[model samples]
Target: MKRFGLAAFDDQQDDKEYEGISSAVLQRQNNELKEQLAVFQERLVGFAKKHNSEIQANPEFRSKFVRMCLSIGIDPLSLFDKDKHLFNVNDFYYEICVKVIEICRKTKDMNGGVLSFDELEKGYFRRLNVDMGDLEKSIDMLQSLDGGFEIFEIRGKKFLRSVPNELTGDQTKILEICSILGYSSISLLHANLNWKPFRSRAVLNEMVANGLLWIDEQADAEALYWDPSWINVLHE
Candidate 1:
């Protein structure tokens, strides 16, 4: 008895069937994702227009709006590149960028122009339920203004540095030392950085005024000027 060899034929048919099903599933998924993105974008664009003032004034709402933007790949600040009449989103984000800078400057006095990302987020969230990720995006936008607004991570903790002036040799040295020691008093700067006592006091005080350092006044103790920018990231 002769039997037809049909094993190869069956395997080939199964393989073709599997490929066809996979391709159809993927195409459906792609179309669905595209449709969802369009709907989300339209909703947000409408929100930006009707609630421009409220979005600018409300931290929580603004934070939510920002997250909405990032997920949709919409950048508010980019509106300046094209005709403003095209979309209200551009104007909305343009105002947001300005507000972020203003907020940074307003709060800089407490931290010497440098605030821990954790601390900043907490403060905003405490009062307004703001999102850190959104604030980070706003800070990123502020960098284009030549305002020295940048976010840095030290030991895994993020920091917001808000200052327009370039750091001097002494200033950079102080930052390097603080990255290790977590704090630098005037004496430390004088001893380690070879700064004179008067120079240390002068520079440290200047940094404090510029929002570059936090000042801790202690009775009968030399003032402790610490870098608020340093985050002692605790390792587990």
Candidate 2:
């Protein structure tokens, strides 16, 4: 009887100790999580202040910042029910959007509001010495407004198609192929896509009208059509 009592007492003691250990472990984990969140919020504020120029000027870095915030359960672009610190998180992006629109308006006649993303970025920054956040993110933010600003890829290149032009299935296919071939003449289109010459020409001309493709008249003088949106090798 005495031994039984001692064993029971020891078991109860072990249980009590385990409860204490569990509580401590949970508390430590909670503290660690809080510390991590604090650090993240601090980093966000730091970026908004110290790297303001870079965040606004270099779009890739701004995108990375957005990704980082998202990974930490934070969205800088969200405007409602946010902590005060995050209120202005995306203000810089909005400002960049205004400047982008101005540039688009200024160059509307040349490219039908369809400008290369690189050219758009360069043009926007060249005019004013202010920062513009990630072009993609700024574009995303702009969509919430009345402007029909968006990005599209054709012929392996990135174009900021500010107009509301939608690509048809055949047009999309042609751009995809041209993106791979760098430049496609009507003959090449008929050969690769099995398209009739007239059909190929029709599609190419339409793309030119949409400002999705450019006529490379100077390069080879062979009436070659190229999608300037296509990157060097391939863009998908």
Candidate 3:
């Protein structure tokens, strides 16, 4: 028993020593990574400044530069400096974010708080001299805020949701059905999804209450539930 006790103590001491060495090694590695990152950042900044004109003029080049920055855990926008005016990368996305907010507010009455990238491109993207990458980055910034901005995909189509409330699974599924023709009715849900009348109506009514679906009461057979995004597509 005495030998066992001494051996246990020795094992514990070994573990402690190993832990200390591991921590020291990890700390050194972390510091080295930080130093390397700093050097890379400095080089990137110099490169960006040198090619500022090309980045601004060439959309493809700008996108590649933004992607490279992100790959290195750097936000292209964060490179902005008021004193130096390194480049206008920050201003480009900042302006796009503002425009997105304005467009959402302007069409809130028509499309609720959800908007498709398709609709946004038609409305302002063409005039703004921006591309899909720029818009995606702008929306990414918005999503980081507490403002309930989120991007979601349904049936391979992406939609930006601006409201705080999340859509339930059933609601999202119904929207997928609506994507066929941009509208779904109780019969449609029942026939395709095999949902009972009560279940279909319950989900539809809840969606209408949440402003996700608009009711078209004048349908020939039953009330048609429409995603407002479809209306924008029709106009286009």
Best by TM-score: 3
Candidate 1 residue pairs that clash: 112-211, 112-212, 113-211
* lDDT (0 to 1) per candidate: 0.66, 0.68, 0.82
How would you order the candidates by TM-score, starting with the best? 3, 2, 1
Tens-digit lDDT track of model 1 for 53-119: 6765677877777776877787654322233343344454455566566767787665566667676
Worst 10 residues of 1 by lDDT: 78-87
Q: How do the predictions measure up, each by TM-score? A: 0.43, 0.48, 0.62
TM-score between model 3 and native: 0.62
Candidate with maximal lDDT:
3
Off by over 4 Å in 3: 1-86
lDDT of 2 by residue, 51-157 (tens): 66676577787778767776877645432112333334466567567767887787666555666766665645644434334666777787786558766776556
Q: Lowest summed lDDT over 10 consecutive residues: which window, candidate 3?
A: 80-89
lDDT of 1: 0.66
As a whole number from 0 to 100, the lDDT of residue 230 in candidate 2 is 44
Task: Give the Cα-based TM-score of candidate 1 against the true structure.
Answer: 0.43
